[model samples]
Target chain A: MLSAEHITVRYGRLTAVEDLSFRLREGEWLMLAGPNGAGKSSLIEAAARGVPCEGTFRWQGEDLRSLKPALLARRIGFLSQKNQVTYAYTVEEVVSLGRYAYRAGLFSGRDGDGGAAVERALEMTGLTALREASMLTLSGGETQRVFLAQVFAQEPRVLVLDEPANHLDLNYQKQIFSLIRRWLDQPGRAVLSVVHDLSLARRFGTHALLMDHGKGIARGPIDEVMTPELLRRVYGMDVHGWMRELLAPW
Target chain B: MTETRTLRRERFTPLTCLALTAALLLTMILCICVGSVRVSFSDTVTALWNGAFGLPIPEGIARNIILRVRLPRVLCVALCGAALSLCGAAMQGLLRNPLAEGSTLGVSSGAALGAILAVATGFTLPGFSFGGSMVLAMIFAFGSLVMILSLAWALDRSLETGSIILIGVIFTMFSSALISLIITFASDHTRTLSFWTMGSFSGVSYPHAGALGAALFLFGGVLLRFSPELNALSFGEDNARHIGVNVRRVKLILLITVSALIGVCVSIAGTVSFVGLIMPHIARMLVGPNHRRLLPASLFSGAIFLLLADLTARTLLSPIELPIGVVTSIVGAAAFVVIFYRTRKVRR
Candidate 1:
């Protein structure tokens, strides 16, 4: 289980996330829904241990900060929105970086029997055909799949994705979500995802957290917290009945 | 399955890298053998063996040339090449900019300024041969790096990578101007300053070779160990951090290490250019940007490239001895243009 308490994030003068507290257990899929500038990314970064924040983060009853970076990375995989590659590496090579912590000895190198894990990840993400393609040659949707495959190869217990489907097309969106669903089927693996599309969140998210200006306005099971009244209050719109159905047909 | 696809990519295997390394060693041997006074291959080998084992070989002209002169010169060239190339590779990886190298970052000019100042001041201490001068050069090289980094930080309101490179270019220009100003005022040391700036392998004794050789091995070992971290860094700082790399520590180590290597190179060889700038790129082309392979390959390729350049500098005009820096600059500038065009085309 991953638990965070009294999380406060500050960027110089501005307070991004103030006193935010939440708990995420194994097999739970929590969706963070917020408008722009609502500090969704900030919270994800803090939880991922990528930035400084005032809070206590624990995994399986152990303090997150106390764990070694490599050990923590093995348990928690964090994927940010932008995945820039300055040099051209093959898809397989990029994915193998997920196994960095597991690599042993000096000059153990990347081209070894770690193929089982890498091949499985590629197969899961449907990137088996493009496994040898250079990352510079990949399209946007293909690159996203490659990153997803990389994270899967890491085999982290808690997967934190910040807008995984930000720039993907509809088909890619469906493909990525289905992959996440397969991941969720496994025991002891949890996902915390920031999503902009309410329909997708309503469809895939097991729990919902409504955030506005860095504060959680509502949090509970998906069906209970995504009420029209609360969403309207948070979004400042009359998102009731027909409007709600139109936004989230499922 | 994509098994066929993997076969088609033709990975740059370790064996290929080893073969390249062997080729470099052969070239170094050839360089030592075929200098102004061609001490035939067999004679060169015998002399080198005799010198190594301390067996009594006639102290003839051939033996002296092989043992005292050409051997030290070649060793110095090899060390400079390896050091500069390693620094270049590390700098490029740290900045995430392929254009970042010793020459581009003004490190060469900075070190030149330090060495030139030492020459003009006639700075000498009792019981030390060029030690004080080398110390001054290293300090100045370190100062130049600090200046470049701070200027980049202060000017980078958006913290763009390109701004840091631009800041380095500005520093390069400023350093060049200062070097020229120093040269203009240096009356007594004008010839020495000019020759030093041009760069050569002349008068390099065993002590000089030993110092540079030890530095190359020490710093090169550290750089080779950082391949995985460098691979992580190629994905950008945030991603590297997320992947459990201590990005700050890596950057710090890279900065200090590369600066020191550059300092050592300048102090020893007087600022040879382009081995650092171009060798890494060639290595990347050969083995991809995976530093695990690229770093070692670049080190060998650098040693070869500079040795050949130095050889040409020695033999092209025979006795006239073209400055090694001139030869490297010509070849390096040409390679840079070709690479720049190719990279731009790839980007487009």
Candidate 2:
């Protein structure tokens, strides 16, 4: 399980996330649902040590900050929303970069099971065919899958995703979520994702944490926290009704 | 799959290593033979063979020029070429920008200023002159790196690539203006100052060659070992960190290593601009972006490219001995334009 305590992110006069805290249990996919400027990404970035923030995150009773970066890497995998790659690295090579945590030294080659893990990740994400292809030639969805494969190859106990399907179509959204869902089926694994699409969060997440103006509106099982009353309170609109209306046209 | 990975990780076998050594040695001998005094290839080889074994000199050959002059200059040039190219590749990987190099980052110019100061001051003291100049150059190079990074951070927290290059241009201009001011104040130093603008290695000696060789292996080895970290970094710093690369630590170490490299090269051969920026691109074209391959490949090509450039600089004009930087700059400027255009096109 992964846990956070007194998490806060600030920028001078503005408080992005304030005194936020939550625990993500094993086998649970916790969707951090919020509208724009709701500090969802801030919290995730704070937990991943991507930005300056005040927080203490623990994985399986171990304070992640105290752990060496390489050791912590084996316990947590984070996929950023935007990746700027300037080189023409092949998909296979990019994914295999995940093996760095297991490196023996500065001059070491791939680890013992590095190849097998990369093969599985590539095959699992349906990137095996594109393994030899340059990342530049891949579509948006394919690129996301390549990054997802990289995180999977890391074989961490927890996954932290910041809008994994932000720019992708619904088909890709479903495919990527389904892949992560299938991955979560394995024991001793959990996931925490920051998502704006309430429907997708409700559809895939077993638990939900809703925020509004940097404060938690509701937290618990997905169905309870996603109730019409609380959804209206945070989103300031009838989210369920809007989703139903959109689905009616379908 | 394992087979494919192994094939990708293919390394130079002992046979290839030996072949490369022989080829490099032969090329050096050939380069030594080409000059105003035309020593035959056989004599060149014999002189080198005898020099290696500490044998007595023969009557027919100009062993003094062969052993004590052109050989050291050529060797120093080659060493500087390898070091500059290696530094270029490392800096490019560190910044994740192809345009980033000693010149573009202003590190070379800063180190150039340091070298000028050292030359002016060291004209007095003959012993440890290379050491003193290298030390000053390293300090100035690292100082310039810190200046650019801090300036970029002040201008934009994100530290975008375009802004960093802009800052580099500004820094280089400032350093040039400073050098010009120094030139005005000290007319006596104008000859050395102008000579630096168009880097020449005609004055290189055996000690200079040995110093450059030592720095090349020392700093270049650090870069070669960080191949995987550099590969992860070229993707993105956040991604590299998530993959346990210790991004900040690796970046600091790599930048310091690059500064030392540029410092030593600038001290020895002046600023050979494009070798660092273009050599890696050429190497990438030949061997993919895997830093393990690209680093070594760039070093080799850079050595060869500079050797030819030095040959052209000394011979094309004949006796005049144009500065080496002029040759590399013309080629580098063209490469820079092509690369800039290509990067923009790809983004669009």
Candidate 3:
């Protein structure tokens, strides 16, 4: 389980996210949906320990504020909105970097079993075919999948993805979500993804957090949080009939 | 299967790189041995072996020629070349910019200015001599160090990699103006400072070679040991920090390492241009940008390139020897044009 208590993240004098509080249990998938400039990225960065915040966060009852980056990285994998790589490293090389925290000793010597982990991640992400290809040559969808392979390689307890599906096509979107679903099926793993696509949130999320003006306006199970009235109120659009048809199968 | 394949390729790259390095070393030895004085390969090898092992040799002019003159100059050329290239590779990795190098950062000019001041003022101290060009070189290097550190500190807040490169250009211009001002009112003895500005490997001696080789080897080892951190840094500071790298500490160490290497090279061989800037680029083109491969490759390639450039400088106008700096600039400019064209094509 992961919890953030009264997290207030500020940059200089500007408050990006204030008094944000949330929690997630194991085997759960939570989606954070917000309009542009809604501080979703900042909130996710704060949660990932990429930014400093004035509050306490706990992972499985341990205070994350005191955890070292190497320790935190092993337990929580973060995929930022922008993946900017300057080196000419191959896909395998990039994915293998996920194992850096696992390395031990002076040179961070490779673990004898890391090969198997990397191979498993490649297989899971359907990236085995492109393992040796240069990352510079990869298409947008393929690059996203490669990064997903890296996250899978990390084997983190908590998976935090910020706009993981932005550049991917519909097929890749489904593939990524299915992978997340598999991760969430594990007994002690939770996935928190920031997404802009409402349709994907409706299809994949078990719970939803609707945010606006740097605050959470709604947080509950998907059905209640994504109601027609709430959707109209949040998005300022007519969705009564649409919501009814969308929820019919559920 | 992929692991085995990648391992095999990885093994092959270093082996090939080593083989090329050895070949270059052999070429440098041959260049050193066969100079303006017609000395046979066997005689030159015998003289070198006798000198190295402290063995007795026949009392002849060949022994004097090899021992007194050629060896020290060759060693200086190779060390300076290797050190400059290695510094360039590290700078490129730290800045995450292909064009970043010791000369690009105004380190060379700053070091030159310091050296000039040392000469003009005759400031000699313990463990250091301000007697001649060597003192000037040391002072120039010290000045360069201060300038680079100050610029690095001023830009620490922004911490944007691009801004560092811009700051380097600005410093280069500022240092160049200072050098020009000093040159305008210089005495005859100081006017010879132009020789230091335009590099020459002509007056190299055993003591200079020893000092330079020691500095290069010590600092080069440190840079190579931190190769993995450099690899992480090329991805950007935030990402490197996220991966458990001490970004601030690494930056300071890297700057010191690069500056020291460049400073020592400029002190020993004047401001030899393009070896630091071009060798790393060439190494990257060959082995990609993994610093493990890039660093060693750049070192070897830089040594070979400069040694050959020195040969051309001495041999092109046989009796009237050209400055090694002139050869480097000419060769380096042409090489840069070619690389620029290739990069443009790749971008398109």
**DockQ, all models:** 0.51, 0.75, 0.43
- lDDT per residue for candidate 2 within B93-200, as digits (tens), equals 877888888988889989988877766665323577568778888889999998998898799876667888899999998988887677777767544665555578
Question: What interface RMSD does candidate 2 have?
Answer: 1.3
Per-residue alpha-carbon lDDT of model 3 for B1-348, expressed as tens digits?
655655554333666867987877676667767678867777777888888999987665388777777888888898899999999899878876666676666788777776666656665556655335455555566566556646765877533444655676687778767766776666643545555566888877888788788877898988987776787677666556555566778787877777767766776677787788789988888888877778888888888888888888888888888888898878777876676566455445
Q: What is the TM-score of each candidate against the true structure?
A: 0.91, 0.96, 0.87
Which sequence of candidate numbers ranks them by lDDT, best first? Answer: 2, 1, 3
In CAPRI terms, model 2 is classed as medium
Superior candidate under DockQ, 2 versus 3: 2
- Tens-place lDDT digits, model 1, residues B91-150: 777767777787877777787778777767888557656666676677788788878877
Ranking by TM-score: 2, 1, 3
Regions of candidate 1 where Cα sits further than 4 Å from its true position: A104-114, A239-250, B1-18, B58-61, B114-128, B157-161, B181-198, B344-348
Interface RMSD of 1: 2.7
What docking class should model 3 receive? acceptable
- Alpha-carbon RMSD to native, per candidate: 3.5, 1.9, 3.9
Q: Specify the highest-DockQ model's number.
A: 2
The count of backbone overlaps in candidate 3 is 4
Instruction: Please tell me which model should have the higher lDDT, number 1 or number 3.
Output: 1
Q: Candidate 3: global Cα-lDDT?
A: 0.76
- Estimate, for each residue in A1-250, the C-alpha lDDT of model 3 and write its tens digit: 8898888889998887788889988877889987776678888888876688988889878898678766887788877657766557778876776766676755544455667778888998888888878877888778888878777777788888898889788898898888878767878898888999888998999999888767888998989898877777777777667656878999
Clashing pairs in 1: none
